[model samples]
Target: MERGDFTDLPGLGKPLEDLGPAEQGHDPDWWLKRLVEREKITVLPPALQLRRDDAALDDHLDRLGGEAEVRRELTEFNDRVRRVLYSTHGGPPVTTPPRDVEEEVRRWRARREERRARRTAALAAREPEAPPPSRRGRWWPFGRTGAAGPSDG
Candidate 1:
């Protein structure tokens, strides 16, 4: 049929060839999935301290060791973490602990560093002795040793 010959058709005016790429290419499911995904966008992750506080609070509660108030504190702490996670940026900080939270964070960081150092030291101590540069293994022929060979002696 001609481009404008919709008079011959009964209901629809447009011809099959006149449809756009989007209308022609994708099925209804594909369009629906795209719409659904756009509707259900994932929220951004929380700040580092926010996530860290979650774990730190967990540790503190663990150290409290099933105290009567631990459950309450855990619930409250989790709520705070969620707030920090979903809260908008450029606003005021999330927490206002009565105790020195920064001091506690420093202590946590120091403990982590010390643990890391001890682990590095242990790994170093346990490291296998590499063969001397003069010796060549099947995998590695080049070494820091001099290029001179036994024939040069």
Candidate 2:
């Protein structure tokens, strides 16, 4: 009943690699959870997803280029949270509160200023560049007049 269809497959004869001691007793879906995490899959329900996003919101805001972009991101996050809260579709309860736009903007500004200060301090710590040489008093290898060649009188 068999052809060479599976002969060329990778890890064909090698034993499976163990992740670690399995927590199968404590959690029946431990393998599934590990697979999800290993694959970097995002399959959380809306409420839980919002909570995760809320946790990393500051980091998200830091990457934005401008205050308007930050405001837009905050507004979008809040809208998603509010939508999850109002929906009857069940998952974990939505406990993540909507962020205040003005307060976040203030915090974002403060963080930007702190980063700028740190960068300025780092630059100041480096040695200053040397000034360019002057043109009027140019140096010559032989003499100011000309090269000491045999043709000179």
Candidate 3:
């Protein structure tokens, strides 16, 4: 896989000094440090200069932890939704059903309850595992580091 140019990243030329206490998990400075330290890119000058001082870094860590929590919640929600979808309608959903509104409603409610119960049981059987921490972040730094580019200092 070929890495591309850093300038081509989603946000470029902008320094990472804007991180605030509340923006924790989304710390641009932390993200930059991660890339420099983890990705082993030699040419690009480490963006350490942009590191937020004072209380911002602490908030950033808190934000990162919250991100982990959000991910867990999202995964559980997705699993339950998928289970409900698959269980309630084993086959492709009927586009047009009989006009018996009351009967259809009754059947649907029953199926939904059954599917939800099964989902609860299945989810309880196992817990979601978080993956290893990755240095990569919103910034997509790429392409030919240590190439004596202009940013190479």
lDDT at position 17, candidate 1: 34
Worst 10 residues of 2 by lDDT: 16-25
lDDT of 3: 0.47
Clashes of 2: 0
* Candidate 2 structure, TM-score to reference: 0.62
The digit string of per-residue lDDT tens for model 1 on 1-153 reads 568776666657545432346546645476566666779954433555565565567367445533345655655665666666567776446553333444544555566567679999999899698877773443435543655554322
| Residue-pair clashes, model 3 | 3
Clashing pairs in 1: none
Q: What lDDT tens digits, residue by residue, belong to model 3 across residues 1-153?
A: 166655477667665554555536566477777778789965521122112221243233333334445345434434544454445534444232112334434444565567679999999888787887887543337755555544522
Candidate 3 Cα misplacement greater than 4 A, ranges: 1-101, 136-138, 143-153
Summarize candidate 2's per-residue lDDT along 1-153 as a digit string, tens digits: 198788789998775554444453355576898888799987889988998899999998999999999999999999999999999998889999999999999999999999999999999998999999775533554645755655423
Where does the lowest 10-residue lDDT sum fall in candidate 3? Answer: 45-54
Highest TM-score against the true fold, candidate: 2
Q: What is the lDDT of residue 43 in candidate 3?
A: 51
What TM value does model 3 have? 0.23
